[model samples]
Target: MADPMHDAPRASITGRALHVFAFPSLLIAACLTGFLPAAPAFAKKPPPPVLTAAAAAVPDSYSAAAAKEIFAEGGNAVDAAVAIAFTLAVTYPDAGNIGGGGFMTLYVDNKPYFLDYREVAPQGATKEMYLDDKGNVEPDASLVGYRAVGVPGTVDGMWEAQKRFGKLKWKQVLAPAIKYASDGFVVQPWLQKRHDYAARSFAGKTNFDVYFSGLKAGATFRQPELAETLKRIASDGGREFYEGRTADLISTAMYGHGLVSKQDLQRYHAVWRDPLTADWNGYQIVTAPPPSSGGVGLIQLLKMKADLKPAFDGVQLNSVPYIHLVSQMEDRVFADRQQYLGDPDSYKIPVAKLLDDSYLASRAAEVKADAAPGATGVKPGLGDTMPERAQTTHFSVVDQWGNAVSNTYTLNGPFGAGVVVDGAGFLLNDEMDDFVTKPGTTNQFGVTGDEVNTIAPGRRPLSSMAPTILLKDGNVALVIGTPGGSRIFTTIFQVMTDLFDFGMAPQDALAAMRFHHQLIPPTTIFYEPYAPITGDLADALKAKGYKLEGQPFNGDVQMVRVNGTTPEADSDPRGAGVGAVFPLSPSK
Candidate 1:
């Protein structure tokens, strides 16, 4: 495999300072005096190099470049995001997928909207399907083979978002992806490593042989079949992919191995829901809501930290004291997650109560200032209610219209179920593994679950994918998200603190080392290797009775900061990606 940084194009960093364009004094006065009916919409203009209006950060350099092209062609954030989503399918097969599904958060005209397109359990799914005759959980039932798949929703979700907010034609937005798939792209070291890891699982699968045969590091990999499929989708719209020949091909393959049927494909629809918002340090944080535990869990963690303020103030960042305090709070919030968060459509979640200020204050009171709390018996904070993979991709986009998008999608595990449909040219998702086979049991990521996220027909599994936006004065300030199994939320939380509390730039924030402590098995603190929390910091944390393990890598985060009107972007250095900015003029 070729090294990602060595093989991929370097990101162009723009040094432009951001400045917000002010409304004319007369227009503001007229609106205030009721002289004008309403405020006029801001007209779209080409972004100037001095004031960047569009920026994108994707896990794959090709995808980022494609998204920037869409923006340069006068598309809005939604259009650019859709282009990124499709292009990723061609370039980053590990997680970028149409056969899997996830979530999206979009900000347009000062309003935030969420789209839940996470894959759903097939109609034939049952809570006990993964259990054996003795009622013991079948280890492989939900992790591998045909039985692991769920009905996919990516196509539906992308179509719905574009239909509502896209400025370019669907066909135009899809052209770049099709071209990449047909002409091929260079494989980076990261992708080669992914292929090596997934190779064993693909053994004896004919479709895998057809698409991945002879793949090598630094070599060109083309998918003419996928290109043809994209052509059909572009010409006929999503209907061709969902209910026409593509659906027929997928149904035929799935029915032979898994439980999905033609009806499942035809019935899938993307749902639009209100985003969850919380106030933090005078800024409003907005993200995906329930069925996804990311937003609520993040808010609860932030509130807990806010309540225990002076504790963090005295302790240096990434120090033993700071790591211990944050880990303690994480345990409490995650306890709440396992106890309450779930799909609201299947069962009601107490989102309002969990985020209540009073309840958070009570939870914060439990934090110990000097010592590490024992992991054994910590329980959820007292509240009346409530309520949620590592294989995923996240991209952040901001366009010339002040519209922004944060999208995170996944295949559940690396290469998903590792099964490709006979002629579909895509892999199926093992998202069913995301659900608990039995109460108190841990899934692939070692995260436990309860009834709230049990497998049921048509139910969307709980997810850690948290596509998020930060707003200041009702305008987008930041667009961020990441891909890492159970570590997604913690990664985002750390990045937020880096930007808001420590005041680091987006690039520096993403580059900083991070740690995670999921409350389920609370004894260990997972820290990224070579991060600041090493040597003395590591020793100090261990002395506090917590096990510290160094992870080679954590989450792959991609972010965009709207410094006033200028958009600045960065992709995690750990992955093969680029943060490309589109200039106002083509000549630049």
Candidate 2:
């Protein structure tokens, strides 16, 4: 099944740009070979979403190109997804990773699947792992060193997805990433800000400057060590990362500074659990479940929003009343989030009771048109709670065969724990910070947690990564997800409502103004600076006792939807990413 140019095993890189190899040029200067018209930038607001047949929408163009390559070789959505995931590790190290872990939602063989590959606490982990002798939380103790890392699961997750439904050989699917890691890819100008930020924040705590110094914009960024690691994984499958040489490197790198060890790595495995699916407004909704509070929160928001104004029938998009109404739904959910959700295997998550119609109705009945109940106003009805990270990435893929995959993965922070394995060349996740390091404390994203989600040996932390798929009748309607820590499910709820209920085009919905409110700090509201609320609307919310602030950006969503059986997708314009469709057509 190899292309003629790939018939022989050979490659050569010329300087920092040109290359003479089958897969080399694909990751070079022109990475969007199958991409459509240029996606809008965050500078502009309400850019319409563009949908095309057999598409892939990702956080970076190189990753999109990798998906395109796999599709060209007759790979299914899952195969293309594997290609995208690994390619991201090479091209978008901040989020796309093999060293971290996340969740996945898939539509295969007319059914739904949810994969929980979230990282887990080490065997040595304890509830007070990040607390000091005085019972105070240690600053950056769970966010900036080897002690921050948990056992990673991305490798096993990807392998499980491929093993169950992928059509291409595992080695074949991993080739593009290996090639990119070995030959290097053109560094986009957009990465400079985040690159600079990482250097400054991690100056003394990590080896970031030593390992990532070459990430200057417009350069050929290569990771030979990472390529070698990928080669071993490709040759031996997922076990290579969990039990072979890569595991040894990770354990040695941690030595006396971290809790992860060879034993922790060997015990890691991805889980295939039933997806959370529901029917609302004639659409079948499917999303991530328990260890992740996303699906539950999403459904609750949808249910609460459904009860408001009878229907979204006359609600103007972003109108004062609309923002007020949606904020009410959001503010109530945090109480539930902080009380009744955590890893199903470690703690009992009251999923069914929390999602029961009677329960949601009771929660919905409490929503009011006035301002939020101020900080500490809401409480868990049934009781319990959890937290997680924000520097994450999401991608949506739909192959020509009606197979779709929506995935979101992260490193707990940009570049993860800031610790890159010396010989491995990948970042380790600070996912341990996702747990309740101390009761009633907030993590990097400022979401408060309780003991229900406390650290435990081998337990997966609570998460808000909501990779989701929606279906109309029996056909796929939408595949979507994003990264915003506490802002995730709320943002996803708004976008999906825009597409289905408000009739906003895909890009407009993706690029539209975004606003967020969390119960931890109930009086403050954060909206994206790009597409913001600065006029009477701001005054209106102010009149309602809300203090508004502008964040540099909002959620960067990667979304795909069906248009009468044809696939279409658009990456968030607020991000430096791309949306592409294979078999390009002039009309598109």
Candidate 3:
């Protein structure tokens, strides 16, 4: 009869902050003696030794710990996922949010579900709002300021998922997030870059400085305003964000500079859609559907690769031949995405034909291992046409009961529209830019689109968030997703191939080098720094008439591979996050 959430074990902010400067005296002595301090002096103390059946991997350590705590509190995979999603809003501000939207692909009790909480354009939104008199897309019009924000769906989406599937109470699932925002958490070193960028770009003009200007590494950064905002939602419900006091703040904040209104917030609702599921060899792949081009693109790319199996028989993972073949597939997939995918409610996408075998086979035949797609960008298979941040966050979860959740959410850009609601403390998403303001113009991620993704009243913009789950023989095989704007689907494809096809360990697969080509500029391929292309491989690719570029970072992928009963997990080292089998005490 006792309350469970309050009874859950959690480290207090002061207690958690103490570990930041652990062994302070020892550090001074070591400095005085000219001896380097040991690893324990700076590294975070390890969690308890108990092992739980539930597992989670997240893009931030604070959110990871929150998931562990929720598992220890007897929450199911859905509950833990809902908890982590909220926790990230407090700790990973660059992408996590209540003021943004995203997609969630869940597998519970052997049934698959996909939730589209993608932000929708305001009722006042218009296709020509961002175009100039000469028809040029205005600069920074959709990238910054208030007009860029869409009506957020994250809070409602998480709430809908929990209400339908989670075992824990809604308020109980949100307790950890509320506490973190009010009491604070030790800021990680990775936050500095985002904080500095927001400060430099917006500063006093947009209120970015009011919130994050004081953020420092290893400091106990607090968000009292966000804390209060979360408390209101906990006491009320997701509706608190849509129709209550929080809604007022959001509308007031956008009174002149933005388009979202109190009406838009009240009208916002999340959708539960059938996941796009396909059979690839023996494994079943499940992912996001239209509105988000990722699932269709991912399945098509995989199918094309399968159809052209003979073309890549002898190529290595990152070899020139393999890269060429993959790029060929990617170019086609991206082309299909622009022409055939969009918000399903508004536009009927050709999902069946896009992933049909006949279509895939025809697309595969065009892929030549010996050459690139040529100087001309590939055209969509439909009529020969088509058309999303690396600054997003993703997390994967699986509980002892076999329920798994692969969730990816974002603010459309780093720190979103770079403005905060005056009284409510969350950043609004720049998702309006996700739409093609003008046919040929690019958004923040440098991806273009056609009318299929053009802005319209209350229409959801197209996205590339591909939170996916792979299954073998009716059991969960892999729970994977990542945060990369245009690079999202391509990055996920690389990781999936490495983990499933190449037989690599979880960590190695996530840490492996990656390549991406989204067909916008079909002649160029981007590769990451690890095991980079330098010698013969680089030459071979160039000889194929493809230009090579080094992207210092790829995707921050979070994954959990089910190996028998054991959960093999790893978070991308590219970002500061943790991936481990959270020790769940049996006694709980």
Candidate 4:
């Protein structure tokens, strides 16, 4: 048999008609018959471990390096976080920097602290300030005018946090931003998108041509002006940005462009707010409270879920009850937000009563198990709030020394106010509209504007910046936050559950599918990553009497988690982020 097979194989088709025909036919038959083990079905090789070492970082390279260096230099998480913030101001500008204002949350030695460095209204602002001749509110025009800008407080907040929780000196922490701004930094893809968004606002403005040209994709833009500003802050501290030469320039620029007055700049102040907290399986999760609705709204939603314990206990992620419960809870939270939440300073918002378990339980009873909620359905008493129609940014840092920082920043709408301070190379925040422009008028999040959020002289605008921290056994367990105006609460909520409850790694948690609902639109927005389960969820939600709209994943979340020994960091891949660990060592 072997001799016969070998002799047959030795035959070659070389010119003879029959031999050539037979050889060609045999080749064709072989191809068609598929006798060969079609590209051996082999198991896909696993991808190389991204979190190769115990220490990890989120995506942004500059930010990752910034955090790493701070930790390497003996700074704890707070110091590194502060350093990363300054570095982000230089590296990521569309978000809040010294020029803009927002909020920060700190977890230090098992305690939670919130810093409210939100912008303040001008001296002359009033409820009807944005009203036109016909008494119609002009939010766009108002936001574009100097009157739209509020007193910036981000610098003060950052410095104040450093004073209390940071280990490294302010200058040492800010040195990275100054160098990046002075030397130049690569304008990443995300920055390019933001630059383009802000570019139209800067058209025909002074220095527009000089500064924006270099912001094109792949361009290395050097912000020497910002570097100088950082230098001044480094020397004189945050006061320079508020009451010093920088303030004067900012004021002059605003005044020249029909924007805010100098009084607003001098009057800016950052407040230390009492953190709102809720218990989840014995772990204390702390977040920002009003003038931001992040804390209250999150609590309301979580409280609703607390009663539905069985949904979270299951192993498989795709359960009908689980999906329905999460969606309904989200809707209820947004509904409450639209009706009652506002600036606690002006509005008589009974936050204590709102977050009360009994109150939330009553609201949970309103969610009908079988249908989409109507606007009139599921109301949260007298002070429901809505998220502003805006975009924002976020960053998180943890140094080796037990100090951690979570911050969320924004300019309200894109290229806030479309007003730029001449020669300052910074954008002013249009945070004024964060106030309710008119009673009963709808703001970004479809919430009814009321007296509480109505504009007033020297009132800080309401925000949704919810930087959060979680403590386990009296130690920092997680530092997390996101950059999505109305969707902020949902993003953070999901990450918390994913990390603490589900025990997912930071990267896996971040990469997981996400959904957002604010109750205004009465529809759930599902991200693409949820595609696999979309049909099933749709059916499940429908069976529960809910309508849904699948949407692309829209928020960027950066998170850090501690698992016994080594800490881990994961930035959303959907964002222009880079996650890395300290010391750059291999995984354990």
Candidate 5:
């Protein structure tokens, strides 16, 4: 099989410039050559053709192409999203998997719905599960091995979304993924790098050799076991994986690791809830609710900036003052996240009080224009009651019928738990690491949490996966999300600012340099390696008493911007993904 990474369409400068430069160039050339038409008056040329069938942005080329194919086959946004999710399970294994779980925000018929399929702790789980006999937090207890695995919800989540709004048969949606797993697909560089890293880190612990043996960039990789597993799912629906043989296999494997039991598998269920929404600059922003700190955090950050004028005064987007302001807001929001956000099902979260205008105003009042706030000193707002990886995958889909789906799924950390089920051919999530094992102590990602997010029996771990949809005048305006652990909400927030405030197109918005500040350690700002804010900008920030630390990359956002019936999509340039706008059929 050919490597889709090589064959996928690349974003071109000329293609983007066609609408802005082509017509002007033609008229200029005609006038220069004395061939300008005398009878015909020049009028503005029509804009480029809009993609009418569907526009999809995904974390992998194969998955994006698979979604496009589903749309071509008459599937709606939900159907295309289902196929893309499954295909990512095969192609983007570091994060996408049937063994993990996530949240989805679907917009259909002008109504939005939220689905929470986040992994839950087994019934045997307890607040002290990750603590050592000496009462100290055991690092490995919740970060690796079978004990770290949570009851997965990806299959059920996708199943529910498809069953509710899909226009194609479930089997049809699973077909592409099944073929990719059985027949094999060319290994892309990103997957190959993950394979190499796993081989080194999970040496002797996992069966990396079994599935990814001889894995190399541009080489064909196949997983027949996974193929059979997908076939069973296709034939029996999601029950086979959740309640039947597959579940039994998972239970037996987990039991050997002393993590979960068959009963745990039988009791797992996905929840359907009202999406958290807020009005932002005349647009309705809808996102996943609790169990996801993303929605609330995003809203709070945006709200804080609502009353403030642009820091750079429209001169530069990534100026020192602008970056400092954004970073300050992030520190405050994350402080609130650590202290308050958690699973509303397990705790009483003050969602209403947190979003109150008065509360937000007080929080925003703490910001200083000339100086960066001390991160550790920043405190959460006093609410009546309260309320939250770098490893995850997000995809956005918009179909011809105006239906849209924004989904973000993950296995917690990359190749979570660093262990794959023996026969299941899927990696289990280490979502237990997401809990507040020891308050005040930072997790692997340098993020801290409080009692609100502590572990408990049947409690879902909090996440930073923000699957968001922007609506203007009750119509879908934007579909966007990303996979960046603590950086997810921040990344999406920056992109939104770029599009709405800076007036950038989708591609430029995603391509812009990004930075992240989690607020736990304070004093340090993690910026992308080649981020725009450097040199004089870096010096300016330093003068303001901020420490700038450069990191490899931050987030990979997949987004689609809607203009009436047309949708333009773009995948993050920081990652090796593809964005495709499927051609409209003649009948449409």
Candidate 6:
């Protein structure tokens, strides 16, 4: 017989033996006909989409596009953030730009750094700047006028960050903003509404006409003058704004507006300070320090909540007990903030005592979880008490090169007091009023600001809109911040809880309508979506003998969260832009 195993024909004695040895004839036939695919099924599944990461833009669409472009150009997170910051300065000038300043917390290469570029009081500033004839604190309107402008440090701050932390050259990073301002940028609905009210202030000025001429409510506005200014800065670096003719022009314009002096401009600098951090459940959060109570106060409140082993699993945010407890903690933190936080260089802060674990434990012990702590139930500082930026914009970026930036910028208010520097086409910030004119007077929050926050010549006032970053095991976990004045810190806190504690996606975390109880108002401000929880919470509070009222509470938060395993960028849906990734990968 020809060898059956070799090239012999199928009808062989040995083939019959082998088939019979392995299986019956029927089984062998089925294996050859149908079950073969399942028999060798060890192929591995393919991986998910290969997108490097995601990004998100908040507020301005143009600025968001600019950030994406920077990432596409091989820029890292820092570079993209710088580009976004500068672009916002031009496109979203009402909230961001060279005219005002803010703070930044960056997590790059497993470490964190704080950049304090908040506005500063001018050299000629006086403690009584916002005081009236009777030594009483003036109304907010009286304080936030032309005379309330400060010596801005935003340009200097961005330049400093770019020079030190940015990967792309200054000119390269600024190209998008220059194009947007010079060529033209369309005003959004919110900007249009704000402009309708502020147009008078812009129109009355001689230089304002040069830029505001073509700006209509809902129409595209061109700021060729601002574009030129940006171009000069891009080419010349910080010198163009701080030491050149443009600086002179800004100073003259400010002086004419009864605000600042040239000396204030010359003396302006962005302070580099250590960011405050608290170790919470193995994660380290870095936020703005003293003179701005955001970080310190937030940490304090978190510590208080931790004491309860707070598992408010089903408790809706707007629930009475939920709002009351959080507000109770908020009040205590604000009290400490008002009493102690200040320009540490100017005064010593008891940060050690204020943030002490035991101290917070004792403070948290004062709360009755099931009961409502009235405004009076919480004493100021000893136990309870209470409280609480600029037109603010925030952005975050992370690159393959391991660079990251979480920055928030601002113009004091929309269009910044509506005063453009003569011929400069840039708005001016009324940031000077951020300082407390009197120790025990009502702040913008309608609550008393602390004495430590009182105004002084050439002092930077405390602010509440803090931008922050968080690190876990030395890797970036979250880059987050917001754009509401007194609500910025509170909004960020809630989102952080959702991300870290609940593991929600950035978009979902931000979109979740929030409630804010500042401890000043015994009531909770509920967003429309939170209405469902209101009745239940109110009844709960009433049963607990707590008084409850309702109001509107809204906030805009934008953030980027990196996945623990793959370093993915998950941008907030509440925003319009995405975090840019270097060496772009296909979208997920």
Q: Of the candidates shown, which would achieve the greatest lDDT relative to the real structure?
A: 2
The lDDT for every candidate, in the order shown, is 0.79, 0.80, 0.80, 0.66, 0.79, 0.65
lDDT of 6 by residue, 1-588 (tens): 221112223321221011111233444433222121111111133133223553544456776788778766655566677778888877666677788888877765445667788877777778887778888766654234467677777888777676765656788889998988877877766665555666665564334445555656567778877888888888889757877777888887766556577776776777666567777867777777766777777777666777756545566554565666777677676667656667664676665567777778888877666554563545555433222210667776655434457787777566676667766678777776666678776665554567667777667777876777777776766677777666777778888777667777766777765666565554444333433345565576566665555443345566666674344444445444454443453321
Tens digits of lDDT, candidate 1, 187-295: 8777877888777775764356566764677899998778888899999997677898899989888766789999988877777655777778888888878779898
TM-score of 6: 0.82
lDDT of 5 by residue, 343-412 (tens): 8677766666667777777777777776645734787777424442106889999886677999999988
Clashes of 5: 5
For candidate 3, what is the TM-score? Answer: 0.89
TM-scores, all candidates, are 0.89, 0.88, 0.89, 0.82, 0.88, 0.82
lDDT of 4: 0.66
List ranges where model 6 is wrong by over 4 Å. 1-51, 54-57, 140-143, 197-218, 310-318, 375-377, 382-390, 522-553, 565-588
lDDT of 6: 0.65
True lDDT of residue 220, candidate 4: 82
Q: Evaluate model 5: give its TM-score.
A: 0.88
Q: Write the per-residue lDDT of candidate 2 for residues 1-588, one digit (tens) a residue.
A: 322222334433221111222334443222112111111211212222233457888998888889888877767789889999999998998888999999999886566767889999999999988889999999999988899999999998899788767877899899999999999999887776688887787888888878788888889999999999999999999889989999999999999889999999998878766577777888878889878998889988887787775634576788776777777677778888887688877666676666777777777777666545463377776643342211688999887767789999999788889999989999888899889998789998889777778899988898999999988876788889998887889889989888878879999888778898877677778888778889898998888778897776578888887888677778888888788878632311
Worst 10 residues of 1 by lDDT: 12-21
